[model samples]
Target: MAMVCEGLVVDLRKLEELSCLEGRGMASHYYPPCPEADRTFGLIDHTDPGILTVLVQDNIGGLQVKSLRDECWVDVKPIPGALVVNVGDLL
Candidate 1:
């Protein structure tokens, strides 16, 4: 995982002073089954403030990514043993 993260940082070569970069924090979320699923959100839509966001999702699918081209919320189907890497606003 460290190697993967390092490679990602290196790939952003345009960013100046890469050596000064560090991991800000780590987080994990658990969304339990809700009766009013349609009326509630486990996490509200927002842009990540950091450089990158690594999301590990379980089999319960609810993740959505807003499309820049269509302006629609698209479901992100969960795949076993897959990691979702998102480029944050800071990038």
Candidate 2:
């Protein structure tokens, strides 16, 4: 992952020694049912500036991706045990 991200064919040990991946992390979010859900958004529509985003889907789905060709937001349905990878602008 580091090699591909950095565009370098270097040793893994050297990459780790450089501490290039120090702040990497994962996060989990929970949004309880809102009575006025239509009046607000948990997260505003925006673009991710990082390299990648991996999402683990729950039965209650709210993810959406905008289609450039159609110019609309499309719902992302979850498939059991399947991972959704979003390639960001940095990639």
On TM-score, the candidate that comes out on top is 1
Q: Would you list the C-alpha lDDT of every candidate in the order shown?
A: 0.73, 0.70
Global lDDT for candidate 2? Answer: 0.70
Write the residue-wise lDDT of candidate 2 on 34-83 in tens digits.
77778976578888765567877776677898899999999888675677
Query: What residue runs in model 2 are displaced by over 4 Å at the alpha carbon?
Result: 2-22
Candidate 1 per-residue lDDT, tens place, 1-91, comes to 3444567676443454554255567787766777887898456778888777888777777779999999999999999568889877776
Counting clashing residue pairs in each candidate, in order, gives 0, 0
Candidate 2 weakest lDDT stretch, 10 residues: 12-21
- Checking candidate 1 for backbone clashes, the offending pairs are none
- In candidate 1, stretches whose alpha carbon ends up further than 4 angstroms from where it belongs are 1-23
Instruction: Report the Cα lDDT for residue 56, model 1.
Output: 76
Give RMSD to native, each candidate: 3.9, 4.1
